[model samples]
Target chain A: MNKRELFAQIQEKKSFLCVGLDPVMENIPKHLLKYEDPILEFNKQLIDATKDLCVAYKPNTAFYESMGWKGWRTLTETWKYIPENIFTIADAKRGDIGNTSAMYAETFFNREKSEMGFDAVTVAPYMGEDSVGPFLNYKDKWVILLALTSNSGHKDFQVLETGGQKLYETVINTSSGWATADQLMYVVGATRAEEFKQVRKLAPDHFLLVPGVGAQGGSLADVCEYGLNDSCGLLVNSSRGIIYAGKGEDFAERAREEALKLQQEMEQILLSAELI
Target chain B: MNKRELFAQIQEKKSFLCVGLDPVMENIPKHLLKYEDPILEFNKQLIDATKDLCVAYKPNTAFYESMGWKGWRTLTETWKYIPENIFTIADAKRGDIGNTSAMYAETFFNREKSEMGFDAVTVAPYMGEDSVGPFLNYKDKWVILLALTSNSGHKDFQVLETGGQKLYETVINTSSGWATADQLMYVVGATRAEEFKQVRKLAPDHFLLVPGVGAQGGSLADVCEYGLNDSCGLLVNSSRGIIYAGKGEDFAERAREEALKLQQEMEQILLSAELI
Candidate 1:
């Protein structure tokens, strides 16, 4: 989705919340195992429960890939199940050299090639320009580059000083020149609330896909404090907190409750910021 | 495979070559289309032809993933077909937060979970410690981290000066502490011949998975000049140059001829270095 279309969805739903459809079979509700594919059923119910309350669905491909080709089949089915208006992100952190990156891009962005075309795909910036440039070739698709990740490992290399700036900062500055806000987004962990301010200085116009808000202990208010822009430039993702909220038969309803709470909070934030 | 076993295989074959099974549907020979699965048949023939000559087989994940789940199935079948003595690498270049990386580890290393067990999987070091830590959890598996890549974009973030050390250098130094050389390896592109000397200084013991030979214009001689360690710490890869060497019914024979040429070159190098 384009920046304007994404912002429009956020305003219409009164939310910029992107529900993470990351399902693990053993962790899913026991009763759902009766289905042909428990993970697919689980994801379908989650989407049905929370689709109205959120603007996007991000599925981390690792969860599906762990299950093998069957899991990949589930991922493609799940992508087909999502509503077209809502943005879909293949949260597969993929990157490579130029020619290889093109194939990776085709996997996530070209339905004719991979039978799964996500609205956006998270990309790793380690290999640099050519690795990221292929995803930008998909006109309306988004490339969410990893920056200031929430994991503890983020400090290992991302925060190291590079030419008087943090490595993540260098990532932003160099990558920003590759594409504009229209087609590019950044994955800034919600846990790095303080760093959000610094990130804003470098990339004010680009939307940030914020993970770690719910299960990873990142505060929504702290993230929204500086992360919100005129475009509601943030997609705060909550995976386990919302999807695995309850394991009972009413799990989908329970998920909606969790999503509704976040949507309500987002609505208030948008109203206060006069963004809606 | 562990370091000793890998070196043993290199000595046994008198070659430290890795065949890259990166197949494109459009690129395979036209006659192979008569098969139920052209790509699988193509890979089977290629493997059968060159199994004795090379020490390892690295099927880049992008080629399979581009075809979607069916492609993933092909990858699983291909992995299962490789000889147990030869090392297998899922050249996925995958990385994510800790938990997510764990899932990726399962996808490539834990065959029970993913139906594909590779000896090593190439990982991107953009996220640092936790991202790479999970893959090391597997007893005999290896994590080949991306260091100096073989593309123009390698100049982007990889060469960025961080605390007076290059980013790729920092990747090696910090990551070396996470796992022993037995479990960890680095991808030093064969194209980056001059950089090999510097890389050797930081990671003298770790094996290097060198891509960008043949088609990418990397010299095996230049790489062996500074890259060869006592354990024969290099697995030079050539994808298009070896696999697509011919486009006719005699494609498999043509591929063998190409692989045989490299195997002979590698044999000479091993003999000269007295590594055999």
Candidate 2:
């Protein structure tokens, strides 16, 4: 899905929240495990409960990956459960040399021929041009490259200066030449709200996948104030804070409630900023 | 799969080579496609042919992830096929916030209860302390964090100055506090041969997962000159150059030949350095 359609979905649903599907077998309700595929069962219910209230559904690949074959089957099935209107992200932090990345592009973007049919993916640009360029080769698929992350180690390297600019800023500027704003996006962690102002200046039109909001103590107001673009171009993800809101049978219900709260606030922010 | 055992395997094999399992469907021999799982079949043959030649097997997770459910299945099955003595790596570059990263730690390192049993994993430390610390929490499992990448873009930020120190240096120095040399490793690209000398000073005893050896034109002699340590802690990876060596019915055999060439070179390096 393109940025315009993603924005429209947010406005129509009155939400900019992207609920993260970082499922843990232990954390999942015990009753749900009775199903043939417990993870898929849990994800289907989560999507059904919060689909209307959110603009995106991000399934972190590592969670499914930990489960091996069963986990992967559940991940694919869960991808089918989400509505077409809602943007789907294969939170697979994949980045490699160009020739290899081309196949990764074909794997996720080309559904009819390939297995992973996600609309977008999270990429690590540590490998440079060839690694990231292959993901951008897809026509409509989005490349959410890592910029300034939301973790404490982000201070280790991302903030370092390169030719008078921070490493993250340099990545933004250098990679901007490879793909346009339409196909490219940056993962600017919500916890680093202050850096978003500088990030916005580098790629003004590109979207930003903001994580670490509800659970990580990154204020929604702080992120919106500094990161939101001319379009409602921020996909704020909240995994533990929303999905595990309640561990009982009412888990999905409580998740929807938390997602609803975020969406309602996002609607106001969009309106106040004259983005919608 | 602790450091001591992994080192023993390298000594017994008389080889420090880590065969890269990056199976691309299009590149595989057509005869294998008739099987239920072509990738798995190709990998089984490749593993069978080279099991005695190499001490470790590193599977780039992106290749399996692109294949979806089947790809993930192939990866798990392939892991099972490898001999117990050989070190296994799930080359999934993962890093996120603290709480979320804790889940990643559980995903990769918790094998007693988890389906994906890997000896080590490649992690991105751009998120700082919290992101990297969780991965280090798992005892006996190695965390191969990104330090200096080999791609063309490595110049963009990895070598940048932060507070008068190179970004990679800062990562190597600071990350020492998170994990011991036994559990922590850094990805020092083979292309950055000269930089390996400096990297050794910061991380004298830690292993280095070196990529870009063959197809990327990184010299083996150059890498060994500056990168080797007392334990021969170097997992040199060659993806396309080995797996897609010939792309014909003899692909597996060709992969063995490519791997043998590297194993021979590593043997010489180890002998000269008196590591074995």
Give the candidate number with the greatest TM-score: 1
Interface RMSD of each: 0.7, 2.3
Fraction of true inter-chain Cα contacts (below 8 Å) kept per model?
0.90, 0.58
Residues B24-135 of candidate 2 have per-residue lDDT tens digits of 7877899988999999999999889888988788998768767767776777788888888888887777877676677677666666545666788888767778877777
User: By summed lDDT, which 10 consecutive residues of candidate 1 chain A come out lowest?
Assistant: A1-10
lDDT of 1 by residue, B1-276 (tens): 789999999999999999999999999999989998899999999999999999999999999999999999999999999999989999999999999999999999999999999999999998989999999999989999999999999998999898889999999999999999999999999889999999999999989999999999999999999999999999999889989999999998999999999999999999999998
lDDT of 1 at B15: 93
> Relative to the unseen true structure, what is the C-alpha lDDT of residue A180 in candidate 2, on a scale of 0 to 100?
88
Please give the CA lDDT of all the candidate structures. 0.94, 0.83
* Per-residue lDDT of model 1, residues A41-78, tens digit only: 99999999999999999999999999999999999999
Best by DockQ: 1
